[model samples]
Target: MNMPRPLIPQVMTTPPTAFPARIRGPLLKLCLGAGTLGLALHVFAADPAPVPPATTTPAATATAGAAATPAAPKAGAQFDWSKVPPVTAPSRPGMFVIAPSGPGYYSLWDVVTGNERKAPPVSPNAPYALMTNPAFEIDYRYMEKPGYEPDLFDPIKRIHMGEDFLLSFGGSFWYRYMRESDARLTNTSDNYHLIRSRFHADFWYQDKVRIFAEFLDARSFGQALAPAATDVNRTDMLNLFADIKLANIKDGPAYLRVGRQELLYGSQRLISTLDWVNTRRTFQGVKAFWRTPTFDLDAFWVRPMITERNQFDNWDTKQEFFGLWGTYKPMKGHLVDMYFLSLDDNRHRALGRNGILGDSITHTLGGRLAGDYNQFLYELEGMYQFGQYSNQDISAFAVASGAGYHFKGAPMNPQAWLRYDFASGDNNANDGRRNTFNQLFPFGNYYLGWIDRVGRQNIHDFNAQINLHPQPWATFTAQYHRFYLANKQDFLYNAAGAATLRDATGQAGSYVGDEIDFRFNIHVDRHQDILVGYSKLFAGNFLKATAPGVSPDLFYVQYNMRF
Candidate 1:
């Protein structure tokens, strides 16, 4: 009913290159944002209904049913309750959890047959309970057991405001200490501290009407360089939305959700909440969904929110992002997802091969397949893009695939996986087509390497990792990555999808370098965790030839408590 586990995914972005700098021009037309907005019109078609009788409810929609699951309600089908999680904490009253939440990623098949998903357990660095449900949308109805025992905070989770209205509360806090050498491979070093906190209130009037709102605070200190754009949102609204169930699960369960919200869909390659960063990502818009026992479909139209360091966050009025994502679980162990996404950015003039161009409109169509056979698991996804970026025609694509095996009963519960990823890049600046793939908003750090380099645009990554759960409360992971340029003429992008290095003449050679990372996560308890990690990049020919001749290293220790 909720999400967690691994299925990583990417995009392209901004700055350092040896080529001559291009000057900006006047505004491009708003035709794209104005033109494609019709696609978003369907999202607001809602017929709000009166509060209905109370009944048992399931998880709300997240994104894709790759965003995985029925986007809204496969809520009817439950999970296998007999399997005990290897990691668990005794639930205390007033606290959020008393037992393990169950497998992070499990399908109806796994639930029906007591099968395992054959994937690594959840880790702090990449946490989400039901891949389809972010922490904010968790279904805590299970907490209401027969003769439920009350804890100091128990009353806060389910408060009776009236005869049928139920209001609940939840929040989380995290602190991190970090150090980096050659930050951004700029021949520099620094140390910093970060703190973030969140609080939210959820309201439900029967099973068909609801409202959810969350607050956020994020800050950083003692950094030598200018803080990244996402590092500082002192205080603001993170998620504020309302959900209306259009129909009951028995009648093809459906929902219409509106307002500001966070989105996560298939493997999260193209869309995600991006929780790894202090200021997580969100959007303001409308979403509608419908699903059955084995499938679900989601449609949405929203504007990406712009985070400001000193003021309240606001949606980017110049850009509009919309999409359709669908998922099908053919029996449990196997799940398939398909999606079509579009983005229009009219904030600034787009630099084209010939000169300045008009606004941008990008359209993408992609699909993903994932499942497990006994102890072996596998995933594959492919995407292609078309449309316009200023005066240039857009033609780009990306692919992600991986296979793994879990030694379930083995000591430490060891597991390993190998993966390959590629996204097209443009080789000719004078060409009429823009070939670089836009990662959209994604959790790129999970797949591209934690060092925050090597985006999904114009790049190739061959990587592998091993996970070991040697203790009930601890997890250890180690990964190695080899990166290369898909097209030397295109810029080298970083994890946040910004262009950090480039050799326009193609003299840099394609090899970007090698990175080895190690991390550890300790499950202090169900609601608390600690994470320690380090990464080092061995500069390859590309970095040595184009940017500073430096290899970067990063280290951090973080503590998180969620209730």
Candidate 2:
């Protein structure tokens, strides 16, 4: 007969790995905060119940005048404890022990098991030892032992209000070389650099409340070469917000946030922080977040923060923005996003098709579906706009779609993708309806092309891209794009929302031009990255008919680091 296997008892314990030497300083600070949290939990965690004594099988006894039958052998004989080797106790407390219990099973327990004494009844000022529970104990693996070394002021880590806080500082420097031939009137070129520095701090209160703030100083140098690239700003407050945990749900917790912050949604087609720009976008607002394992929802009401060339930036009180964004991930690698946004602007420039300048209100409804399955990936998005612009009726729409495939076993881990985009334009200037699509605030450079010469309004874009990872740290990309006017009568708008070319007579052809771009990225290390890129555009018939159709060329090299 086969002997029954004994089931081993398991204990929940922390892992044994320690933080690496290089990051020990930062990790220690994190641990200090965690240790404070552990202390707080100790004050609240319930006392563990008493451990029962080890159970033993009673020996068989013969009754008076009755012969005791030999105890029937256990159905599956247990190992004789006398014949088994004894386990040596751990040399230190809190160390784990794994002992063989029977065939194919093991028992895991702490060396101090059964020896721990029960705690006294609760008291207002209990001794530290009474409040110290192993479940709430701080793992020294994540931190240096207390009194192991002298204390030092770490900028990135601190303790305040009996709680743990963190403070950090970081910055980036960027340089670009830009040249354009026959840019409407003259050939122009410029070399400029941008310095962006920021300081951030986070304050937490027992995982229930958090306050965050960041200050930024972004400025441009050598901009005199091209006065048009004035994306500079003096020192200013970027983000200041308070996040409060509202309640716990089945999958996770909900949060309410208020104050000045950055708002970014899927793909950033309609709303974004636009971090690529020297002075990024931000908003003063109230936002609510509800997240679960399968879905997330965000709703907000805000006004855009206007970047004043002056030292202190201000909020645009006359303009209000509100939106609801939600994403659903029903399965791994698949995602769907839906959103509705409303913008109300009191500025005079936000006018209507009838040429009246007044307040404008626009509402946008859109959704995106994207997924990656096996080696194939796809994305699709569509948006429709309606409302009132001054006296005219507002109506417009846009669509973007992309598909790609990865060659799993191919050299270089190559992948290829194709994408197309379309945005509506005013069909007839005389019409009372405004049809030109508004891009709102977006990362236009990423969507239009590497050259970033066109806006996402009244345009048609077709693009193809090839990507290769030549090494674990290096990537190469080649892209081609064809541009066209969605409507012949509409103006050719640039990324800055300016008309680069227009044919009032509506005789200009639709074909704009074709562009080719090549780029390479190298992630030198965890803290450093390098990028190099070149792009060339071949002028088409419409460009030739409207002005000097000189082809444009661009090249740039960039390096970035963080600490």
Candidate 3:
């Protein structure tokens, strides 16, 4: 009799050498320690005695073995061999089996029945997706199967606590080059190079508790230019959070999390982590999450983390934020979201009757409805704000709507869309009332334009975009935008939440500008990406009247890699 060949495991022989210089030493040490600890735990956690494999009657076993020749099973007596478990070799006194239980080993029944079983599903290759695996592996495909016991610190088949602990680490390095001509409608032309590095780790125990942490380092080198509001943080702690499972609900689960982390909501028009920036935004506080098959809810109380040029950045206690966001799916392809948010800032400045600055407290209520039907998609959202700003009353509102269609069988699989956005502005400067809408923290570049010269405050934007996927890993986008001030008396705000070009006299025309943008994105593989884009803004009457309107142009190229 010929025996089947035993499967050999694949292991990493050397460590990766692509990490940034600053973190290479620490990261390498951490990984080595984790590997050693995992092996030790595996060896000590295994059961001393192995259980015997299932068996059948002697006569049946003999007959099955005799019929297990190369020939197929008999015609009328087909048997379902899948129901028969595989047989294993009896355990030796002190020998251990490192391999897991899988289909490589077969039984006499399997051979006699001549039934082929289906293979297991393959895992995704993406870095983010692979991070969920319990064991760490250089190649994602070689990672251990979901339930395979590495023997790692797990007790005998207990209830919920039988699962082994998990540890994983990953990081990314990104470099970008940017050039701006007539920067921000000014006479100056500026150029710069930016480098960013991030390292993160996740530790989970028994599927009930998780501790995650991430660190970031961002720097710039090149010609002297005005510092960008989003890109200058040197080194900081990005995220450090703990999540604890509370209960197993009807169709989903509930969790409570505390610490500093990222917050993102639908459309990102009101809140987001702002990943495009070199230094992403984070919040410090607590959040409660509950979900079901048809609906999900989140409630959080957090303060935005303030970024400083120094390393020791802290939460801004002066600013307090709280919100409740809920999403419900009424049907297969439709979604509705409702949210209420509040902001209490002792230092918030509001425009007064005579150009004075006063503190502000604002509350916002909003809802969104989105759906996909066939090849068509549509979304609509509206928000209203009311509160007090010093001694003045606050009343503001905003509305956004968009529609798109995908050409399924087209040459390039193109998607074309149109959008319009409007935010209320202060109509009477001397009425002791403020009406300019506040956008809070949002991903401004995603909705507006790549240049991000205008924000979602007292503004009107009309945009059209076309997206094409020429290949499975590449995308191209072209967009055009027309901008105007919702009220001529109000100021023009930029993505940084700062007023860029304003006319105090309210004599400038409402037209802000028109912009054209082109972008290309290429995914080299699961761990690398390349992005390039260009944008040109044609100054309109208002811009020309307030600042140097030389038709500002911007170009950027960025490369990213993950491990």
Candidate 4:
């Protein structure tokens, strides 16, 4: 019985395997090389692998005596998803675009979405609650070169947290440290650190009513003079403002907002927040903004606020200001704007160190026009500010204009613009007119040598910029700037006798050599990006004074993340 069972194994049959030794080795090598080459290509080219479009087309059919035909729509203006870009759930109901570099290197453009961009439509019956889209950023940068002292670096961040409603509240904070280099202080290297913060709130009521308020606090710490130590610090240079608005009164559509608010009118060459510095220059008075279907109007009365002492009392007391602004858009791509301003400072004295006046009124009026042609964008803006102050009771004025263009046919979307600035203010040696890229009053010179000298005086500047976008998530830019002083120093004589005043430097019309700035950015993921930039400040007499024997050159790299 045992021998019978063992004989059954002899009849067992084996199945053939799928793998063949003849082709197995070549197939394995082919797949491995393909994967390795694909990885190498990906590593060299930053572009993500292209994605194929997903779409479905209607089927075609043949008729008895007609060529193949497709089905026709039962027309009533149906929605066409194919004509629009694919849309995911929108992140929010507003547009946010941000780019950051080193310190003083940030661009923020945020606007409440209307019907454009297919923003979520307003529904009266929908949920009523506060919804906001907030973002923040921080950057650190440094560069190394021989001879020059290592540049002082600091932290910069922007805070924009607020709910869009009848009213909104939020603010931004900033701090910086400027270390005077081994050389003396010429604007190049100053051993001073500035810390500043601001808070603002805006509210709209009854669909047409509005209110606004803002507060600023700042501190400047560091050695006013080197080699020794002293506690002569400056603190709490506070600025406060408030305003109210009334809209759509009676039968006609009109509105009015009165109080303290920074008047940002037109393109900002004339009146702007001057956001370059930490503490912003705010007006302590009232303003009216009226808008209709075809035209909009903006007018204001303001007083420059510098110190916190009697902050609200001296606001519009010595100087009463007024402005009338209007804009008209008759045709598509065409816009026209004009403004008239008046400064009534009766008890006007000399323009003080902080740009305040004792007595005497001044008047400023200007206008601007902008329009778009086939593929070109053009803008023309000019404003004149005239006022009387000082012992001579002299009159000073300023003018600014600019134009820009875009080349849609360019390989990499390209845009270029040119601007000219001519402004006049205090010319005395007093430390007034904070020379900053962002300033309240209309002063020129955004890119001063290492030091900025366009503050508190007469200045003229010419600037140009070109930008290229080779990819949707990357940009490259080049900018050039030059400046010159227009005011000559007049002799000043004291009652004690002789004279102690002379405009030796600026009198001959000081000049700041042309500066070149080049920068580029690469957006990695959705919330992060990298930036690289270089700046060369040509040496000028004014620059030398701020930093003797110093050639200002800066190179920086930074990574930014937003949330």
Local distance difference test, each candidate:
0.66, 0.56, 0.62, 0.39
lDDT of 2 by residue, 1-563 (tens): 22111111100121214322323343344345434533433332233222211110000010110111113322333322111111110010000001111121000111124322121111111111111111101111111122222212233332323223322233334444444444432355545666666555665554466676667677767643444433766777677777788876544456777777777676666776665566677877777776554555667667788786555666676776777776665565566777777777778676555566767777888988876578776788899998777777789999988887767666666777789989888767547788988888775665676566778899998988777756434557787889999987888887656667778677878888898988776644333456678888788777777766467777777655433
Q: What total of clashing residue pairs does each candidate reach?
A: 28, 0, 0, 28
Pairs clashing within candidate 3? none
**Which regions of candidate 3 fall more than 4 Å away from where they truly are?**
1-162
Q: Which candidate is the best by TM-score?
A: 1
lDDT of 4: 0.39
Q: Report the poorest 10 consecutive residues by lDDT, candidate 2.
A: 56-65
lDDT of candidate 4 over 1-563, digit per residue (tens) = 01111211221221223223322343344335434533443343343222211110000000011111112322442432111111111110000111111122111111222112121111111011010111100111011112221211211211112222233344444444444433222334545655555454444333344444445555566645442111111232223322233534321134443434454555544554444344444555444544433455555545664444222222434544555666555554455666666555556444544456555334456666655466455566555544444333444555555566667656556767776665563455354332111123531222232233234235566878676756434567777877655544422221111222235555333554566777676544323445566666575655454345665554545443322
Give the worst 10-residue stretch by lDDT in candidate 1. Answer: 89-98
How would you encode candidate 1's per-residue C-alpha lDDT over 8-89 as one tens digit per residue? 1100111224211221111022224323432332232232222211110011121111121112212332432111001111
Better of 1 and 2 by lDDT: 1
Q: Would you list the rank order by lDDT, best first?
A: 1, 3, 2, 4
What C-alpha RMSD separates each model from the true structure?
11.5, 22.8, 19.1, 28.7
**How would you encode candidate 3's per-residue C-alpha lDDT over 1-563 as one tens digit per residue?**
22111111111121346333433444354345434533433343342222222111110111122111122322442432211111111111100101111232122223346533232112222211111111111222112223331322122211122234555566678888999998766778989988888777666664477777777888777846767756777667677777788876554456777877777766577887676788777878777775554555677767788887655467776776777776665565566677778777767476677777776777888998875578676778899998777677889999988887767666665777788989888868789788989899877876777787888998999998787756434557788989999988788888866777788777888998999998776655445667789998888889888885467888999887765
